[model samples]
Target: MTHAETAGAPAGDVATEQASHGKSSLPLLTLGAIGVVYGDIGTSPIYAFREAMAVRPGVAATETEVLGLLSLIVWALALTVAFKYVFFVTRADNNGEGGTLSLMALARKTFDKPPVWITALGVAGAAMFYGDAMITPAISVLSAVEGLELVAPNMSRWVVPITLVIILGVFFVQRFGTGKVGVVFGPITAVWFLVMGSIGLYHIVQNPFVLWALNPYHGIEFLATHANIAFVVMGAVFLAVTGAEALYVDLGHFGRKPIVLAWFGLVFPCLLLNYFGQGAFVLNVGPENVVSPFFEMHPDWALGPFVALATMATIIASQAVISGVFSLTQQAIALNLLPRMIVQHTSQDQRGQIYMPQINTIIMIMVLIMVVSFGSSTAISSAYGIAVSGIMVVTLALLLVVMRRNWKWPLGGVIAFGLLYLVIDGGFFAVNSAKIVQGGWVPVAVALFVSLLMVSWMTGRNRLAEKTRRDEVPLEFLVENLAKKKPTVVPGTAIFLTSDVEGAPTALLHSLKHYKVLHEQNVILTVRTSTSPRVPDDEKVTIDAYNNLFFRVVVTFGFMEEPNIPKALALARKLGWKFDIMSTSFFLSRRSLKLGQKSGPIRFWQDRLFIRLARNASDATEYFHIPTGRVVEIGTQLII
Candidate 1:
């Protein structure tokens, strides 16, 4: 079972307070949100408008079609992003953190016993996000770099090679951390948005007739009139709202007010103006100019500079998603959705700044493969919207549960609200699913593979825990037997780590069976992962007096936290445990698995995969930051 499956106490006031304390200036936070949270959507204008206009291969977009497409794009932004995410979904945060998994945690906390469907939805959403993660970097960078074809006609061939180099550089710099480089991300993105709005406004003045697209009738009319190609157009139209999920995912980084203000004050208006501007430009210029209208907006002198700016903006967009993937992986490990991997803290002051080599390398490889396979931005754009659309639909489904259960909305209102957004999000999902034949299968395959890996790990761990429980002696039994027959008492403390505090640790049992000695102070240390994002220091350690010589220690950490046994043990002192690192010995169990004789073909293959994953997982001592010299490992054999 996942840690979220077993956790009961809900973290509310403390988590919220921790999230809000020592707040940055509202303006600064707003700027940061614009830079990081809106990067993907901000860069959409570079390709979104061009893609929508180029739906018919040889035909130029007529004034009617331009207005219709623009209207569709406008309403999509207002409804899906502004209405659903900003105004409504942001309110359903889990103790000030928001995401698919965080929403899952919140919804699960609302009920006495969470339904199985909730976990399914959360896992599906997260898996789909990995699909988005891979495609966003490929498409965003390719679209931006493709502008080089406009800067110098002869430079077209270099786009792919240059893009690969830049991408590799971005991944290479990830180990060094983003603290210094991240400082300029907000200012640069801020300028990009302003440029977008300015260029868009200039075009709107040149072709004032394009403003007619703002009418909802145009959008509805376009959809009705273009029945045959509506599905394809809708998928392209969704490219406009690609990065909307970032607003909710990065909620914990910058609070709701900053994000909300950034959206209204800058990002939203700029995006609308840019999209409208692109529409107006397409109408003013003839069909010939539709191919690279964004670059065409600039004069020859500014074309190179504009391309450079767009490249930077695209890189920033890619950076945001990459960091988001890292964050999500940390949450997955803590929730027990995946096995433990090495997580390195990149910043001392910023807890969220972490680096996972395994994830980084894997994403780099996948992204590079995507870039090479698709070759061009327009080709890869065919694969972009499907995963994001799936995520949006899943988010709305999970939000329905949150509305009724957590928000306590009346049944009628909840149903009405859910049904409305469901149609909108579901429509996007349906249309995008049509792109699967045109290279969209890449993300679908990635999502399915990740989902299978996650489910396998969770299932295998649960079965392993069950087997361990059956094989091990109960903690009470061990304590009672030790009380009756005293063993040679060692001088110092021995802390045996275990998942089940009620049962004797395998390491502890082995020590008694082999060396035949017990420490003066025996601690049954159990590390628990909470459903919330960050646990307060005061609530980190909970101690129970099991007996005179033995005690139980449960160190509770939020999923976002990196576990450190020594630091948590230091916190134990505040709760009356005199924890001394030098004199303490940490004991851990190392399991060597053997396939079960009763397993069938499918079960046997899954067991094999799980065992390989277990073998590759980071050691408990390293993952928990236990001192190496003071640790002891006991080996044991187990059958799946």
Candidate 2:
């Protein structure tokens, strides 16, 4: 099925089911959710518990401390992942799509015209998400591969190289599409979760006292007593819910029902079991003897199989991140924050599966660099908290704006929700404050770099738009002048693609100036990308025909949908638009940008950056899917 067909499907699995199995596919969809949606958080059991325990400063191993830390981790998942994201943040989705950009688009739709701050917040959040994306695969895969150390301590040196090889293979297979392999993702993850729960259960039964951590007071008392250590430990404790955003971000693919069922039915129980089981082991055996508690939990004979299973689970987790960045890149292109890049549909059977070569290459290089630099999962754990914490805080901040302004909640109600998450998020963010020089700087630096790119792109576009608007003549004036001048009428159709449909296109003006003739049927075609995710086919086009043998056609596309001019024009048949591909000539303005002499809303240096970006942007003809044979490129220069 194409993206257009699945656009209305309830879930990714449902889409596949409707294509193959008709309507009887709820169980399959829920299982599918297990594989894709919960991959990241599911794999956390391998490292999160160990990392949190290791972060305690100057504290001896004790049952009270173990229980306390476990309590904190459990509550963090409940409040942050379950309550904050699934409960509230997911509810703020824009037309069934959820993510930083989708939320930003939704916020933009909430007002007559939103302020600049909304755009800034969205960029910040998105940049942070990219930073988090880099860290997730590095930490998740390494953490899983690091299990080799428990089975064969001598093979510790090979862990990094082995992980790099696995990741490299994953990236290599991306172009071939994951449709065949993706079928088993749900089953593997489901089994992984079951194993995690069983192991934790066996250990938890050995010491039921671990259940005491589930009580709120032990966690409160632990924090109250060990304030100093508790602060630092919160950073590691955050690892438990690091990829919680996946739950919300992948909601559109899985839908609310299957994702919710997968979560409440299996993912949550298994995670709690593994966490509490680790806590129990620490309480009974003491932290000193617990050499990688996660792997060591199973029988000695199960070690090899456990490692193999873990490696697969982590790969699935990393796949989620890779797929997410592709979607985010697509959104950025649609929103005009980033220049257009080639987006290829990876799976003809799956609508959401897309691959961008440039983005895939960038992520591959960065992820390898991260793995080589960090060496071990334990070393990279500190950096993980920073990226996840930064994203979470930004998400919560945006959620507050949505509740108060968009939802029109009472002031008291908004503040209550704000304070609820703020206390939890503030502590996690604050812990990473001390680790800036020790790898925490990586993601923060990345977020800043990405945010800089976005801001420069937007700033340049705005100022350049203003500069062009000043020089543009109204379409009415141009039409009246053309009528008086009596330019020769040509036989073929002319389609001038313009950003501003009401103004005369530079290409159209140039065509008239140089060729000295107007086409029999002229169209000022403007493609407008809306803030929504998908627009209905029936309402996709609007046409305005003036009396000067001229036409103004506006094609609307959702931010999630790709623009195809030929396809869109086919729908304009009712408006007397014949759209003969052989006879239609698409005119596009190719502007070579130069830096402005002085600083304006954006800096001179920034303008240079913008020019660089504009020059590298995808060709208008290619991006709009226009036939190359019918495209006429008119060149010009613009200084801004």
Candidate 3:
């Protein structure tokens, strides 16, 4: 069945089922949530405060300015992360999966036809994630290692080189998987948060006046009165909530309850205490202490050890985003937003633990370039917020649709909610936009390139599918003709993989034209990606026998799943097809595409790029997990 055929069942049921499954293991899930979901946002304190203080580069930050900035950061976290994501956006998940793409999938189901705008938003959001993936490690590790300057001034020059080394090490270990070290990520991060809170609490006691920043009025007054400096300061202040988006993005791994419980119970309070503590310590000592306020608060004896802890926290943060990008790439490929790449599952027990060498290498190169070019955490901070801000805005837009359609919220309520958050998200995006000349252009440029690449792939794939459907013979016709004038029947079953289930596959056509024989049993197999995140095993395969000679089979895998054709095909036995894997041959068409004489829907350059992408796509046999010994590839040349 197609998506439309399967849409009869309620969508939220899967999410509810997924939620219930995590209830028995709530404590463990919450711990894992704290480790993975909060890792990125958890490390914000290292440089967020210092960057906010540097709004006026040479001048010492005044008490009002410090309080005001602290107020802005706290409110941003409260409204943006706490309220918008935890309380609301998570409600719009697609079959227990959350992310821009997941939300887009949910929203797309509301309409009879998939909306182009929703797709564009999803593509744009996913593209921006790559930018975030690259900058996250560079900025995070650079900020953490810069603490060496506080431990020993001479080590300041080693910050960039050391950052590069740490990043290299992080990517190198990815192939081995994080499952082994993942056990400690939670306890370590929890300890890190507690220590941050403890240090903050100690300073807040010394200078209770800093607590005044907790009031929202200070944040509002600062924005209203300091118009000249507020814009630049707003961009810097956003660093505090940079990793907040990860909460919604990783919603599928750990369910909603555990994530919410972990946040409200521990992560949220610890962050507030630490931020307030930094504020108090800066006010008590002097604004000059703001140079490295996170490290400054630590006792001389603990600075080295604390710096090491911070480095660990940052590496975990980096790992979280890197894993996230790999997941995003998988989702994109399943949806056909990008070309296929190698996805290696590193752990048998954990379905989500995956490593993509191409994505890892690409991110490593980009991160090293940014670290070498920016040279400091403070410098690279300019590029940090743009992609995140853009993603927030996209997620918010998609959420409005989900509210109006999926949740059955009134149009008025949806509008009111959208307007409220739009201003907040729009304000951050607007402020971050000002940093383009100051290195923000890097992510923006990367996003544009990636978006174009996605658009090219989607457009070209659609065109090719249309052309193939037009040119191919209908399966019904083929079955009728074969029955009338039978060719020599071969001994075993032959499964021809195709994009269109209704049509005879290209590989089957080529084999018959050259060899003049049909297999004793022929199967027309179509693998589909469902809108939901995961399909149940029982519903994975549907077998439709057109005649004894040909069977039309549709194997549906959810977007978040890795497709294993052999395993899925084994399910056909339940439908009365005598399955024998060793005797079956899986036939695939390998298309060698070239530029056509006349122009197509896409421009010449985009067409060429699309051809290039098609050529580099991962081998279908390996991607589909078909046994190499039983796979046969038929080459076909095509003009785009």
Candidate 4:
């Protein structure tokens, strides 16, 4: 679970950026929100309604079954996106950050001793998101390109190659960043939504009675009577709200007011109009001839341009999913749930416009595999909803924990909210689970593999920390011993970094044992990552004197704050230390980890994984933004 930044806590870069974004102009942010936040759900009409009706082929869909599916889709949009995300989940932000991990951070803080199971839920949710990330680009692009069949039936043979080319192009441009093309996103997405509404309205007017599906009775009646068929159909219907969780994850970028306004004013109405329009078309004309109601709505003259526009829209949707995965990876690194990857800040002005090459490449590779394997959107669609449902079910379960423990709502209120959301989320999950033997196994296996790594990393870190803490000697004891046997004092300042604030740093002790010398002014620096988002500059550092040559410094940062040791040292002038970067040496420990024969809590294989993870983690000099020329690394071997 993620934690918030606290006063005097160690922090990183995301908090300050989120703070600035939280204060952006409402109308401008609202425009940007439509492109990024609504991309996933906006593209749903492309395959959602078509998939639902096509789930049970051979048997023609009766008008009642069609209305039932329509009712199900419409209500799912309202409850999942409009109510669950924009209304409830968005309010649980930790200083303008929201996600399964972010909410997991908030939910765990209510009690002194956090429930261990809560952390598992957060990790699993993150894993499921990664699974969704892998499939979204493949399926979205494939569905868009499939529109080619309408323009030219023989051109269908080239769909896979065309989709691959487009996927590669999207991943190839990640290094250049999205700022150059982001301006056009808002305009194009806006146009796409308007067209969706217009096409949907054109058909809806032809079958004016189709509006009856908007009433809850149609959905309730369908579910109450058609239990068996409804149960199976829920899997396909679940796709209608697949990107609902993304709204909360990206909530910090545009702020709540703008996102809410964009949803209520534009995204919501347009989506409903288009969904109802697709249903109207299906009901007016029998469902047998309609492979995709979405493409079928357009006349022959508009087919080519519509396919081109769709390809553009789906690409934007894929871009948003890719960007969201990068953001999640950042949060996971800060929370120490994953190893530090090379994070590239793309835009000079907006930190939110950052990218990760490692993750982007990984996702792109996975997308290509999926496109090659499935060969078409219909086959790929079978693998889609399971991951999304898994994530949603887990998020809602965590929300129940947040509502009761953090919100301080009464038990009755909590139970009502939990049951309501859970039933909706749980029902979807159960139905989707039935697809496991079918193509659904792909995402489930992916999520499980990721969860294995995440859980093992956290477990291994705790074990290593405990073993290291036992070997730590108090700073006061080291100082007193040094006074009795004072070594030759060096001319420059020495800063030793350690997680154990109370003890002498292992690097510092090693430096004295080998070199037999001490710096004129020594500082034991303990950099902390706090539970909040941003820490005040004044509260960033605390200095305490041990003796003439020995000093202890504690630097705390918020989870969203950047952990820049050099910047913090420059600000150390207040504590009577001469801040000269040229004369200072930074001491850091490089632990060479190996698996132990004797095991305690973790499995034998887990220790090996952790050792491998620690071995390959990003260097402290680079991660903390410390100078390389003045840095000293002390090697320590640990088996855990």
lDDT of each: 0.87, 0.82, 0.88, 0.83
Candidate 3 Cα outliers beyond 4 Å, as residue runs: 1-24, 57-60, 600-602
Give the per-residue lDDT of model 3 (tens digit) for 348-465: 9776899999988998999999999999888899888999999999999999988888889998999999999889999999999999999999999999999999999988898788
Q: How would you encode candidate 4's per-residue C-alpha lDDT over 14-55 as one tens digit per residue?
A: 453455575667678888889988988888899888888876
Residue pairs with backbone overlap in model 2:
none
Q: How does candidate 3 score on lDDT? A: 0.88
Off by over 4 Å in 4: 1-19, 57-59, 574-576, 599-602
Error of 4 at 115 (Å): 2.1
TM-score of each: 0.98, 0.95, 0.97, 0.95
Better of 3 and 4 by lDDT: 3
Local distance difference test, candidate 4: 0.83
lDDT of 4 at 60: 78
Query: Model 2: what TM-score?
Result: 0.95
